[model samples]
Target: MARYVEIDDVRVALAEPVEVPPRAFVGRDKELQLCRVAWGISSDGTELVDSSAPPLNFRLEGAPGLGKNEIVYEIARRLDMPLYIVQGHEEFTPEDLALLLTPDPEAVYGEVPPLTLRASPLATALYEGGLCFFDEINRVPDRALSPLASVLDGRQYIYSAMTGMNIGPRDSAARKRFRFCCALNPSLSNEGHVLPEYIEQRTLPVIEIDHPPFEDVHEIIRTSLSPSPDFLVAFTDWYYEQERQDISVRQAVALMNYAMNYEQHVGGQKTKIFDQVASFVVGRRS
Candidate 1:
């Protein structure tokens, strides 16, 4: 007699979660290489061991839609680290950096808890030896930046009011463990926000990226197009020439998808499809 044990259905075995593709952004090889260099400096123990040695910090500044954020994402990806994104804004405060008080469940209904809250997710991640991606860093107020000065210098550590504890005196290992990176739009004469000189001093070796070359832009479109086809590149180039301006490759990919869907349901006419794409691209500018 053969004895057999029942097995769970293979289909019932949960499939590995699909990795979502990162957001579409165009080329920035030079920026990415500089980031890698900074990352290497941060990871090497000897670099930070000497108190006189400067810390490794980077600022990536560029025009809007130039892939600053994407470079940060890619650096974290390549390093196999988690990314914590903090979006900077004009109203950002110290509470946004260190902690804020919140209503504790144990507290009386009318009373607020006195203890400090955990820093923003990004700050906590930075203290915990992870990548912190601060977007639009130039927009944060100067006063609010004081709390981060020590951490940025690699000399001060974060103090969590929630735990009544200091997070660092980062061991050599911890110093070599984490990295901080930021992205921001360059401050043009017309821009309202400006980063303080102190904050500016902390960020070194600024890297700037530009919109990708046409070939790279075309590749981004091809990769993101839902129904991949060889002709997609040619079509995208034509659209770009006709428009006489560049929108994100992401926008182009989206327009292609929308046009394809419209063609299938409305009519297969190429002119109709082109019109739909034009509405998304050129029409937006007008």
Candidate 2:
């Protein structure tokens, strides 16, 4: 169920954060440290030297499936805050970033106002001081992202014309706690989906992430797959030795998951299982 909060005299349903079960997170220590530094968070989890300055908003640039979202999730988990995510798309509008009007389920037909305002994830984060991540930000049309200027800047708020309201932190504490981050593929820059200069300017200290090393990948697979197969070592070695395009962490996980399922079904020999998974998962016919 969605929770409701009163913002500027208007009742708005807060957007729920993305939820996933706790899992062992592997590697990306450098990237995680970079994000922590950018956010003014210290090694001990305390706000750094200047508590008065609001945390800087940063953008994570990486290829698809490279654990960009996982980085954000890890940060939110460490901070123990709600993580509101707004998935970017080509058709997003300014209003979509702030508020939307939906038919009121409880309103009496033809008697009371038929519409209720719901806060978007970003707006809910702003109002409630939660962490908000805009994924694949480059996919959102430039026009739809115009409203983010104020929200990302020192002003630290967004004005919604629909309700004629300025939605932001309710108090100093909320302002201090509120944080924002975004992720997008830099490759999209050449594909007519480049970020606006102002946006690029406001979202500072851009963090560039690449695929994790093989050792980390091995750890990820070992940790993610419970009671990992004994042949996992052979499979990882084969994957690294193959002269094929590098797969993202997600693809690697998927491959291992398929291999586990295959093992369960066939109860095959180790070598055969590896061959089948490699052939099916990576399109390499053994």
Candidate 3:
């Protein structure tokens, strides 16, 4: 059944957790464990004290299309909590965080009903007490992101000026399980943001995701594209040969997808299609 809560007599639906299909999710066992630790999982499988170990709010910094989003999703999948995602953009605002609309009492002949607030993904994540992921966080303007300062720290509450109601710090059973993380994509961060220093200080121990090893990269590509063994070998060989190591797993997958399309539409040799995408698409990215 779908869960809900009452706030100021307004009924609000809680975010629900969705399951991901079990696929050959090629590597990152180490990072996965690290994320688990951040989210309050201990080596011996016991919940640590909050006073000594405050709740972990992670900041994932990496290039665009580097599987940062996937990493968090995997964390949520493991934790078995509702994953609420907020995509940061130039236009993101505090209003966007909590969308509130009052009932038009005059429009209706009967008595006015309670004012239910339409919560944003952030609010939903906070209210529901799950993993809240902010994708491309740096793209959100400072003014829009300022309200988050209260929620990231000891306060853990976002008071929506529009709604005149508190949105977070899940007081229910889910409070203990709530976690938050945000990703900063340097390549795609065209819109600048003055993210508060307080927020940075609050979300401790920043994690950096770099290029994966050859075997893991190949595995990632194989699972993503399912190319033939021969094609996989050639593609990996060519990929590693390049002096620049900027190509991420996501980029490699895109290149292969384009190669497959090229082979389908243009009717080239199977191997040559891979080569064309490498030279054109991958080369341009590099």
Candidate 4:
């Protein structure tokens, strides 16, 4: 069938999904390399399709705001394919993983509006050989992930009851190009998130992203806020020491940002802005 075939009352998006590069994906070259390996790619830009265990899936584990989303953005840009994203949460349901039939935007309410099959990222990636990133996947409940187990396992297909379609790579070339990966927050478990073991086993290389080194963190701050003062970098790096486990690259940037917004309180003293940000926001969590 054609990529954009209209089957029955449903219309599939045959064209590749849109891909936008991340504006400031700072660190994690090593993590990106591991993801490339999981996707059957090698250091020298060769495909390892014939490997003994050729599985193109990954589960990226890290604390919130440690640049997990940024890694996938880089991968999508490198692959030069369509990027599909599915956000996971407590209320995530199996139906959310398939094609959704919604009122067509082009049709008005009075007219007989054709229902458009708002295809899920899972199905879109499978159909068009693209990258699918499941953000905060651990937040999704056990039942919601059942459909995912089949896709990740030897079955290599997902049955969308909404569209009554079994979505998978159309041919060998499509299969070789499609990639799937997930980002998970370590704290989600504490928030009562349960990852189904079947899905866990199907996934490989649960890569853990720890905080970047002091130097890297400093550089990230410097590069992120070019023409920034040296004191800002020194102070931010020092603040990081106070919350080794709690702080992240994102939080550091926020502090700089918060400081800038609270500049009026500093009376034009740039360094004093740091104090305002630290003290202004209590119970700060990233």
lDDT of each: 0.60, 0.82, 0.70, 0.71
Per residue, candidate 1 scores C-alpha lDDT tens digits across 1-286 of 2111111211111111113246654467666667767666433212322334444678887777656766776665555565677788889886677554543334457776544233465445644566677888878888887767777875657554444545453355556566777777875414767777777788777887766776776677666665445346446556665764466555555666776776678865554466556666435554
Question: What pairs collide in candidate 1?
Answer: none
Per-residue accuracy of model 2 over 119-231 as CA lDDT, tens digit each: 89999899888889999999999988998999998788888878888898988778887889999998888788998999989898899989788878777878887535566
TM-score of 2: 0.90
- Predicted candidate 3 versus true structure: per-residue lDDT over 162-185, tens digit per residue: 768877755755566667888887
RMSD, each candidate, Å? 10.8, 2.9, 4.4, 3.5
lDDT by residue for model 4 over 140-256, one digit each (tens)?
888889889877776677778766787777678767677789888878777778577887777777899888776676777777766357557546654754454456778766766
The numbered model that scores best in lDDT is 2
Clashing pairs in 4: none
TM-score-wise, the better of 1 and 2 is: 2
Q: Count clashes in each candidate, considering only residues at least 3 apart in sequence or on different chains.
A: 0, 0, 0, 0
| lDDT for 112 (candidate 3) | 62
Error of 1 at 147 (Å): 1.5
Worst 10 residues of 3 by lDDT: 43-52
**Which regions of candidate 2 are displaced past 4 Å?**
46-50, 105-113, 227-229, 283-286
Q: Estimate the TM-score of every prediction.
A: 0.73, 0.90, 0.83, 0.85
Candidate 1 accuracy as TM-score: 0.73
Instruction: Report the C-alpha displacement of residue 126, candidate 2, in angstroms.
Output: 0.6
